[model samples]
Target: MSAIEVLAPGLLTTVQDLGREGFGPMGVSPSGAADPLALRMGNRLVGNAEGAATLEMTLLGGTFLFREGGIGALTGSDFGANLDGTAVPRWASFEVKPGQTLRLGPTRSGARCYLCVQGGIAVKSFLGSASTHLLSGLGGHEGRALRKGDVLKIGDAREAKEKGTDHNASSTEGAHKSNRLRSVAAKALELLAPRKVLRVTPGPQSDWFPKAAQRIFYSSTYRVSEEANRMGLRLAGPAIREGAHGEMISEGVSLGAIQVAAGGLPILLFVEQQTTGGYAKMANVISADFSSLGQLRPRDEIRFELVNFESARKLFIEQEKLLAAKDLIV
Candidate 1:
């Protein structure tokens, strides 16, 4: 069977899919790709299901040798990727031959990158997902980041071909050089800017903070703290004080929930966040821009902008349309 032999395991490289859903009730966090959009896009480019398991690389990417010829794609961040020492393009698919080594350098822009192979990575699934939940060590390849000498099996490429979704059938290298491809690539690259303004809506515990704290949160610029991880993003900025009620009963927390700790610092919850949090949340990032959080690096500046539910819903629909566009991949 076709497989990828890991020559070097990059910093925190793990297998992830759409995530483990319907298990939050069991106290399981919905661990998945930090940037689901990028995973989906890379899978689409390789003609695999949108949620196919992918190798999510954080900060730095490593080297791998393909044991069989196949098609692969990299998306999300530009990690100075090269195939057999020849530089390759991000957000595009390319052919990989057996014995060819793929290498990825330190990140140039974004914090995370997704590598997708045709037919996806064949790994044992837990709770119906191939995602790696590090905290619980529940899924993915032994439920942890990859290590050197690990051999990852590849799914049946012929299945994708029979389904008429083989990316090799249409040359991605040639088509990806077009103007339309350039536009999409530009948009993807824009998501990795040093400073970002994210849209948010009031959280369930928004009232716990005074109006002044809310104002400060919206107006002040916060820097992504080095303590940030897949579980939460710790922001260092203006202290947001609580009102009459300082503490609250622990309740369920959702992705993007901005919870304020005892020291008045806000922590933005992410994919691996706990199911419930005791701190009060002032706001929650809208679904439309949640994926952008995956690209934020340490010391990156962030500002919050309030948006209504309707506007947030519209933006999400627009993003969905963009992801559904087949021509965008080429």
Candidate 2:
């Protein structure tokens, strides 16, 4: 199949897949979609599987000329994309004709956006995944961002159903449970704004802090600080102190591990987080609410809530069920 020719690469675009798994124990970071939800939903809109390699565009997207006929989807940020000078709707799959010129501008809403083609973007694999480890320079366009004049191959074209015409059908959630959406099923097709409410589970080191510290974490409002990125997000808010607590050896770190630094500042870890950290972790923003977290830009206001592991699991299940039901109609 012909590939998409990069004419004018955007600010920060890279080819990514579902992300490398089972390599965390080896000190290799699980570098995947900073926003897995957008990756999955965008791929679903097209005909690609959840783990397929796609393009991750930062705030500003770029231009590309389709050399082969295919279909694609754009999700997450609204960068005001267009095809051959005609506007293309966000969160929907559209036909990409050969020789067509597609253009994307700087982000207007969310910080990142994903572009999923019918045939996934084919990139070199590292550690068994196509995701790019920016820090270590693994599986991407030579472990770097996409460049102008790059010719990335697209998977061979296969006929897919009329692009999500079916409704009410359930979908698989994170390789585990199946969920069904009950409410707002009617608005599945209607273009709307992002509905974001992030829920979180307690961290492994929650007990390290006192009761008052925990209360402040949940009570004080926070915003995404300017010093945030794929590795971690440094939050700006009340200096949440861990009263009468001392430091310990660094333990396992995950995508949403909330760590309080020496200055009493809080930060949220992301995909490129270190294998271990020594900071005091208070809680973890659960997987279900991670999409919203990924959307946050510098100074974006947000709130936090505490939850148990079981409750967090249940929330994740519920979200997956909702997405499944939307699959039926949208």
Candidate 3:
């Protein structure tokens, strides 16, 4: 069987998919790709399902040896990758021959990068997902970050190739597919352009914060603290002075829920965030900005923009429509 042999596991490389949903009631948060859009695009580029498992490299990237050859693609932040000493472009598909080494370095654009293969990574599923839940250590390859010398099995892509979905079918066909994919990728990039300001809507506990605190949250610039991770990001900015409402009961929290604890600093929940939180959530990031949250790096400066539910819904619909386009890939 075809497989990937890790030569050097980069910082926090892991197998991840779209994540396990509907398990929040069982204390499991949807631990999936940080940049879900990138993962989906990368998978589509390689003729795999959008939720196919792929390697997620954080900050730094890894080196791997492909056995029996394969097709792959890189997405998200550019990590300066090279295959057998030849530089490879991001957001496009490439072929790897037997014994070829693919190496990647530190990120050049954002916090994370994804390496998606045509067949996807073959890992045991937990709760119907191959995503690695870092905090809980339950899914993926042994449920943790990859290590050097680990061998990752690649799934079968014959079905896709037989159906003429593989873009690298022939030299002539490949050139045409490449041009088409480049155009689509360019559009996707524009749609996911980096933004320092994240849009959000009021949370259930938005009233807990006074108008002044709400104003501060909306206007002030906050830096992502060093304490940021998949679980959440702690912001270092002006302390939000919330109205004194006695400690309330803990409730369920969702991705991008900004919780303000005793110190008044906001903790922006992420993919691996807890199922529930007790701190008062002053705001909730709109769904359209979820991919923006994934690209954030330590000490990165960010701001918040307030929008109504209707506006947020519209933004989400527009993004989904673009992602769901039939011409997203060749």
Task: Say which candidate scores most in TM-score.
Answer: 3
Model 1, 1-330: lDDT tens per residue? 789999999998999888877787899998888888787777767766677788999999989999886788898889999999899887777888889999998999879999898878989888888899988887999988999999999987545323322112333323342112222355544543323899998888888778898888999999999988889999999888654244788899999999888888889999999999888888999887877899898899999999988998998887766665545553
Q: Which stretches of candidate 2 lie over 4 Å from their true place?
A: 159-197, 244-246, 326-329
- How well does model 1 score by local distance difference test? 0.81
Error of 3 at 108 (Å): 0.9
lDDT of candidate model 3 versus the reference:
0.84
Q: Please write out the lDDT profile of model 3 over residues 26-52, one tens digit for every residue.
A: 899988999888887787777666777
Error of 1 at 221 (Å): 0.6
Global fold similarity of model 2 (TM-score):
0.87
Worst 10 residues of 2 by lDDT: 176-185
Model 3 backbone overlap count: 0
Q: Which of the predicted structures, 1 or 2, would earn the higher lDDT when compared with the native?
A: 1
The TM-scores, one per candidate, come to 0.90, 0.87, 0.92
**After aligning candidate 1 to the native by TM-score, how far in Å is the CA of 80 from where it should be?**
0.5
